[model samples]
Target: MSEVKKIATRDSYGNALVELGKEHDDVVVLDADLAAATKTGTFKKAFPERHIDCGIAECDMMGIAAGIATTGRVPFASSFAMFAAGRAFEQVRNSIGYPHLNVKIGATHAGISVGEDGATHQCNEDIALMRTIPGMVVINPSDDVEAKAAVKAAYEHNGPVYLRFGRLAAPVINDRPDYKFELGKGVILREGKDLTIIATGLMVSEALEAAETLAAGGIEAKVINIHTIKPLDEELVVTAARETGKVVTVEEHSVIGGLGSAVCDALCAKAPVPVLKIGVQDVFGESGPAVKLLEKYGLTAAGICKSVKEWY
Candidate 1:
């Protein structure tokens, strides 16, 4: 069997920016002294005149991005998720989100996959923070193809967008020809009638693996990948919930206000069903290998299968 290709979503973000820059002269990139980490440095290398390094001040970078948007220039402010979403919350909520500007926030190194960077750098709450800002489009791409497509989509959209990327290199699962990237659509990867596994970001791939494991045990599992978390493809989620009857949400973020919470919110209002949220259990992450952390937090495919079997 051929080995599966893997590429970090952060790398995809940078490569996509370079392509967008070549196509559109109005596209500019700003970084809070984290171009290398956020992979915006690739854009910097390609378009030195367009890339702006705003030092370590994430808040100031947000304001600058907002100002640039007023001039009809689409600016992607790049930084770590911790500073971009957490530290610059006020600026992002007021400057960019309030006015509803065409500014994209490229937040890389999100979730516990940040590895040895520990809890301070691992931003498991960024999705929740971005989701709270009214009119902010929150997107967490699953793999390389999806992440690149999301960057172009965010540029085309005419409002504040928060694009979440990860430090971990994820498996490329959406390389098939049938795959499509819609701004607010969910893709059903596998069809089954027993239960539904709705996942976002890196967990989407893991959900597919868990589905395979469950299938081996004669338990059919439907898997849905939700790339756009803000609009949340509620129709798909509701339809899947009604069909499968049971729902399990998986994500690399905290269970408090991330994908799991969003799924529950939708299901509660529309299709109420038994739900099992698999993610960070509302605790801070510690310094460790990314794989070990995921294993410990029960974010792996085995962990997911174990949780499902125990609950189901």
Candidate 2:
């Protein structure tokens, strides 16, 4: 098996947001006083005037962000994923989505990746809820390059954008800026013809590893990096199924409404392949290390390998 390369997406967002702030003066940052934790500290340090520390009020922060965006400024609101989705969901939906404001929601500490913070802090159903909002663009970038591109894309694309990042470092799976992020396109990380593993966020790297593991077991699994969850890659999902008879969708999200459901909807409605959804099987996270949570919930590469091995 190949060694997993881990890099937190929160840091990627923070660094890329600074780059964005440097590129454009209109790029503003709104944090719920969690600058360093959410990796928005770099932006705050670089552009003090553009940083709005809302002092722990996630609801107010979302509203403030919407108001800022209404003034023709690009506001990237930062907070823990739990507060961003669970605490301020109504504010986010009404202020950002209903009004169709140009706000970029940079949700940090996503999934079971929030190792020690426990179930209360971790957000597995966040993406599913965010995706339900009409005109909302939900993105889960798998690497630094995608993080940067997603930042720019959210800024350029005139609508509400929700981007989730994790606390724990995951693999920097994406190697090139060779591709630009289309609002609804899923990128192919690895191509194969036996079974397909459609994945998003940190799971993309794991799915790739799982594919390799399956190959050694005489199974060739295709891997799709589903960075965009809302406006899913219908073409790629159908295409992957056509190429491979079986599908295994992975994410650090809920098994029900997250990437798994999205892929299954596409595959069942169109391609109609045998799909196995791997994720937090409809349960909240526990107070433990990320590796332990991943292992407990079967989100790790070894777990993915086991799932594919069963089918093979």
Candidate 3:
């Protein structure tokens, strides 16, 4: 087999922004003094006129992005997850979400995988916060290909959107030419009859790896990649719940209001199957290496496999 590719989703978001800027003149990029870290510097280098650095004021960036959106320009406000989703939440709600403006929030360094940045910098609740906005479309892409496609889709979409990105260099799982990304649709990566493993963001690849381990023990597991957290593919989730009778949700975010909660919510009213949530258990993050943090937080492939087995 060929060597697997590994790239950060934030890098993919930056490259996608550059490509979008080249194709659309109305595309504008804004960052809160984190151009290099958030990777919006790529767009700034490619299209300096369209990219704007808003200093360290994340709330001000949201307001400026909203103002630019009012003029019919597609503005992507890039910032760390803590600043974008936590600090500027009010601006995002009133300025963009309430008015239904065309603004895309590229939130990078999300979740505990932000590592040594510690608890304050590592935002594990961005998905929950974004999902609360009425008109905001929440998207958490699994890999580079999905992240690129999600950026284009968000641009084509004509409303408020929150694109969650990660800093860790995760494995490129959707590198196949046949992979196509559609907003609000879950991709079934592997099929099985015993149980279903639903995952998003960096945890999607981990779920795939766990599925392989489970298969070796004569436990066939289905893996579903839920890139879109809001406007969730309810049909697929309900079908999987009913077919498998057991569901497991894995994510790099908090299990409280992230993918796991969303999955349980979808199934609670419909299929009502036994669901196990595999993520941070409503706890704050700590300083550690990305890989070590994942293992400690029960976000590894082995951890996922163990959780599934225990719940099974």
Candidate 4:
């Protein structure tokens, strides 16, 4: 069997920015002294004149991005998820989100996959923060292809968008010809009637693997990849819930207010099925290898399968 290709979504974000820059003259990129880490340095190298380094001040960078958007220029403010979504919460909520500017927040190193960076840098709560800001479009792409497509889609959409990218390289799973990238739609990767596995970000690939494991045990599992989390494809989620009669939400974020919470919120109002949320259990991450952290936190495919079997 051929080895699966892997690429970090952060790299995809940078490469996509370079492509967007070439196509649109008004597409500008701003970084809070994390050009290399956030991969916006690639855009800087390609378009030196258009890329702005706003020092280490994440809040100031948000304000600058907001100002740049006023001139009809699309600015993608790049930074670590901790500073971009946590530290700059006020600016993002007021300046960009309140006025509804055409600014994109490329928040790289999201979730515990940030590895040795520890809890301070690992932003497991960014999705919840961004989702609270009314009108903010939250998207957490699963792999390279989805991340690149999300960048272009965010550029096309005329509003505030918060994009979460991972530090660890994930397998390229959506490279098939039938793949499509809609801004607010979920993709059904595998069809089954026993139960539904709704996942986002890196968990999408893991969900597929867990589905295979479940199938081996004669427990068919439907897998849905929700790349866009804000205007969550609630319709797809609801329909899948109604069909499968049970749901399991998986993500790399905290279970408090992330994908799991969003899924519960939708299901409660519409479907109201039994749910098992698999993610960070509302605790801070510690310094460790990225892969080990995932294993310890029960975010891997084997962990997911174990959880599903116990819950079911």
Task: Give per-candidate clash totals.
Answer: 0, 3, 0, 0
lDDT of 3 by residue, 220-257 (tens): 99999999999999999999989988999999999888
Model 3 TM-score (2 dp) = 0.99
Q: After superposition, how far is residue 32 of candidate 2 from its true place, in Å?
A: 0.5
- In angstroms, the error of model 2 at 263 is 1.3
Please give the lDDT score for candidate 4. 0.96
- Between candidates 3 and 4, name the one with more favorable lDDT: 4
Local lDDT at 211 for model 3: 99
Candidate 1: tens digits of C-alpha lDDT, residues 163-280? 9999999999999888789999999999999999999999999999999999999899999999999989999999999999999999999999999999999999999999999999
Between prediction 2 and prediction 3, which has the larger TM-score?
3
- The candidate 2 region of ten consecutive residues with least summed lDDT is 171-180
Query: Which residue pairs in model 1 clash with each other?
Result: none
Off by over 4 Å in 3: none
Give residue 53's lDDT in candidate 4 (0 to 100).
99
Candidate 2, residue 185: how far the Cα is off, in Å = 1.4
Cα lDDT, all candidates: 0.96, 0.88, 0.95, 0.96
All candidates: CA RMSD (Å) = 0.6, 1.7, 0.7, 0.6
Question: Which window of ten consecutive residues has the lowest lDDT sum in model 4?
Answer: 117-126
Cα deviation in Å at residue 134, candidate 3?
0.2
